[model samples]
Target: MAFFTRLFRPARASERRFSELVGPHIETMYRMAWHWTRNTHDAEDLVQDVLIRIVNRLDELEAADKPQPWLIRVLYYRYVDLYRRRQRSPVLPAEDCAETGFAAEAESSVMDKPDRLALAAQLERALTSLSDDHRDVVLMHDLEGFTTAEIAGVFGISEGTVKSRLHRAREKLKGKLHGSF
Candidate 1:
């Protein structure tokens, strides 16, 4: 059994290191995944798939200066891949995501306020109305607090382009929300 133990040691070490390197970013990954997927089950599956894909790339991940952007980029690509796959073959109907669900989770502490819930629901609707690229930029920069440079890096776009997208996204959101309030 010593031979088997020796054979698996590297795998064990790799798993430990992957957990250490990845644990800190799981919540961020989940949040981004949730933003893209809009369903809890899909979000969890996306995160899991990303993690599985990256398990063999722990060396590159470890060498990164900041892993969050790298991780988010990978997650974004995986989401895009799944999106494209779904486009090619419409196996499942898109979920009718509750407009209030996203906002409700964010405003859990203030659930008693009807105005807050209403605003949250409206914001959710407005968010869903934005195009995918614009919505991503808005969520990463405005909501997740990632800087424009980081987002540009993730998407392989220029900082100016990211800023432009963000501006356009915010303007669209404002227009959608203007009549609601």
Candidate 2:
């Protein structure tokens, strides 16, 4: 009995520690996931997937002092994997997408402030127009307030590449928004 108890004690303690460390960042992770997925259901699914991955790799995460970037990196990679998988699959018919109601919600959300909402919609369109790499860099650095170094870390690239991507992304956004305004 003593041996069995001793063997399980550390595992339980580690699980508790993991939860404590990760609990505070759940909302942030969900927001980031939502930005990437652009829908509540997909965002929740993505966050759930990320949490599962983190829990599975809890041993490796024990040494991580700051887990936000690590968590974001996991989320980003998961999104990319899903994106690739989606590309390989056949597109669903329009009827299949009717249940999501994403378009109706989007339109209603913007109805309150016509000018600002229009501009925001334009910006979202521009963002979606960007290549995935450029869009990720821009979103991480600008909207999420991550530094170039941190963005590089998240993407596993150098700071110079991050800066270059960010610069080009901003230029592309500027061109897209210029015509709108």
Candidate 3:
């Protein structure tokens, strides 16, 4: 409607100053953050902080037509900084993990206390015991549903490298899961 247009008609002058145009990109940003952070609370906080920065720097961006790379670059830097900060801080125990939906499963537990349940829990335990880099690859590729290409972009690596890393990670996970099986 004309009313909506009028409300958003203020900053449409510059190609890069289109601040109101970010509404459609929030989900993608959150997905990127989630892929990087792995933890739900950290992902949500990272997305919110990135959005605030984007809003403040909307007019400063050199490329408006394709903001994805720029946005993702910010996310990558933030994630790295967050990683460093986490290393310097005390880690929370699993029992102390906030109910931030990180460990929640919405599916019905049709295999309650079944052999499959024990094996699955053992596999999860195995995964939680992997190195940080190995865990990151699995989380980004398998858990967060990101393509190898997108992960390469996030990690500033080539798609081939991403695939190789993912393959190695999978091999390790397979061993752990098979050991439990």
How accurate locally, in lDDT, is each candidate? 0.84, 0.75, 0.63
* Candidate 1 local lDDT, 25-79, one digit each (tens): 7888888988988877788789888887998898899998888999999999999
The per-residue C-alpha lDDT of model 2 at residue 166 equals 95
Off by over 4 Å in 3: 1-40, 56-73, 86-120
Backbone collision tally, model 3: 0
Where model 1 places Cα greater than 4 Å from the true spot, the runs are 1-13, 93-100, 104-109
Q: Which candidate, 1 or 2, would have the higher TM-score against the true structure? A: 1
Residue 163 lDDT (model 3):
86
Q: lDDT, candidate 1, residue 176?
A: 97
Clashing pairs in 2: none
Across 88-160, the per-residue lDDT of candidate 2 in tens digits comes to 8898423334323323346667677677666767877898899988988887888777889888888899999
Give the better candidate number (1 or 3) by lDDT.
1
Please report how far candidate 3 places residue 128 from its true position, in Å: 2.2
How much lDDT does candidate 1 score? 0.84
Q: lDDT, candidate 3, residue 99?
A: 32
**Weakest 10 consecutive residues of candidate 1 by summed lDDT:** 1-10
Candidate 3 lDDT over residue span 1-181, tens digit each: 2322333345445423454465445566676675456566667788667666666676554454456555666777887887788778798524325432322331136346466555555665666767766666677778656777777776788889878888888888888777665
TM-score of each: 0.83, 0.75, 0.59
Give the best candidate by lDDT. Answer: 1
